[model samples]
Target: MKKLTCTLLAATLAGTFTASALAADYTFKFQSSDPAGDKNFQVQQAWADRVEKMSAGRIDIDLLPVGSVVKHTETLNAIKLGILDGHITATSYFSGKDPAFGLIGNTVGAWSDTTQLLQYVNYGGGYQLMTELYAPYGVKFIGGSTTGVESFVSKVPVNGVADLKGLKLRAPEGLVQQVFAAAGASPVNLPGSEVFTGLSKGVIDAADYTVFSTNQKAGMNDVATHPVQPGFHSLPLIDISMSQKKWDKLPEDLQEILTTSVRDFAYDMTTQLKIADQQAVKEAQANPNITIHNWSDEERKKFREIAREQWKVFAQKSPNAEKVYQSVTKFLEDNALL
Candidate 1:
């Protein structure tokens, strides 16, 4: 009887261990520079949801928005040091570390449309190049996202290039800042969160915040009575990335799951933002005091000329910058846009 009882006990212990092993769980977190209420933030949450369902209970994900979990500037470093699993960061912020990362940030005139940018990154080796550039720093580029283009907006009338000089403009990194500085405007560097307050208080005279939808949300029209068109400084192509260490450690199945879902999220986000941007512009036009200005062909050509010279200086400073320029140029030529 004692021997029989011991045999049954061992069997029960073995069954418990097997069940526990089968139920093992893996959880990870993802972060972005946008706030929770932003569309991009919602997309990140959607990604997490899809990933969890695909992985069943074996994998879990959490979303961190804005700089809530990590400072925007420090996000890349945090992920490199293994402080976070993944993040959606601007190519501009990382330019100081690797100018090649600025390829998407500064690729003006190369991509005329969102679809073209998407094709180049996913199919034209841009995506692979981005990953290679980030690899040495212990980060992995996980394709792209859409923040739409950065165009000019102001409280005063800006009818031409001549009007841009001497204006206090808020500019992000890459060609946009360079263009404004070259044109003699004092380009201030401020994060996205501070633009509204800066404009309201007259800290900036003109600014290029974001897509029409996001800019509307930021209330750029509230203080800036005039908004410009043709998006002189096109700042499109935001990217999503991962910590190399964390990515490699993920189960092969989990990695595959994220790889597919993130790309889908990116495409969806871009399309949605584009639609919203168009509508926002129309809505902004309804306001009585706001005036919209469209650039002439001659005016557009002048901006491009200034950009060409600026690109030369950028290329001279960073080899990565040159590589990105070449890649974008190739894409443009292949598409016959050049």
Candidate 2:
């Protein structure tokens, strides 16, 4: 009887120790503007999962995606205020805080393929430039993921530049809006969550969101009759950011786990977006109600010209912009991309 009692006590003690250790583990919340099933949401979840597994559950991430608790445009400030812990944002969306954030997203243009977009942002010093730009705002930059080329979604068919003039369009970022204004289009600022409703109601005639997957998810297809391919925008580099205060509070091992997890997130998002874009195109083509508009060479040239001009204006705006421009230019030249 004494032996049995000793064994039971030992088991209880071991269980208590394990429970105590778990209770002492770190916990955090990850928030995003995208809802569940969003590519960014999936990527964020994958990252969280990777971190938890890698740390053996020493770090726990509670994911809140799709702006469930906060508005999409308010996510950055929310994180800064500690209202949320982390999130993924597009350069264009976040660029409202600083124009420099849009450089990477804008420079590549609609003709810039996914490879070009990734090369420009990752190897071209785009990420470092972006991180430095956001540092002053009390946010820690994790990295970015390309969303595939951005294209115009229109209710009216767009086969050439002439078709774009005077069109009321939803432009999320400052630089992108400027690009639209330069092209003689009316640029309106709106949140991602409102885009579909706005387009359906004719509140805006067009939108330049990244990739087909996002648009289809947003139900842009139902409202817009046409989608122009070889999108003028590149895969937008969605940024994964954490509040500086929370980041600094983490232990070195935890920080390492997070940074590594972010890299994994980037990879997952990039791969998923690539696959999504293809699937989206296939689905769009199959829909009889949707018209897939292909740009004429002349129209493509005109758009590229606008993009190049915008790049020059962008570089001239600030020293940081110039640095980012020079880095991207050098990278493009180095790889013979031009």
- Give the TM-scores of the predictions, in the order they appear: 0.86, 0.86
- With candidate 1 superimposed using the best TM-score fit, by how many Å does residue 220's alpha carbon deviate from the native? 1.3
Off by over 4 Å in 1: 1-25
Give the alpha carbon lDDT tens digit for every residue of 152-231 in model 1.
77888887678888999898776768867887788999876788888989999888777667777778877887888547
Give the least accurate 10-residue stretch of model 2, judged by summed lDDT.
Answer: 104-113
Clash pairs, candidate 1, are: none
Model 2, C-alpha of 252: deviation from truth (Å) = 4.7
Backbone N/Cα/C clashes per model = 0, 9
lDDT of each: 0.75, 0.74
lDDT, candidate 2, 1-338, per-residue tens:
99999999999999999898776277777676676876767776777778888888888888887767787777778887888887776656655565566676456453366666655556767667777877777888876666567767899987887787999988765677777788888989887668889998899998886577778767787799788876764456677778888888888988887776766676677678778878888888888999988887677778767876888897777676777678777887787755
Name the regions of candidate 2 deviating beyond 4 angstroms.
21-24, 68-70, 105-111, 245-254, 296-298, 315-319
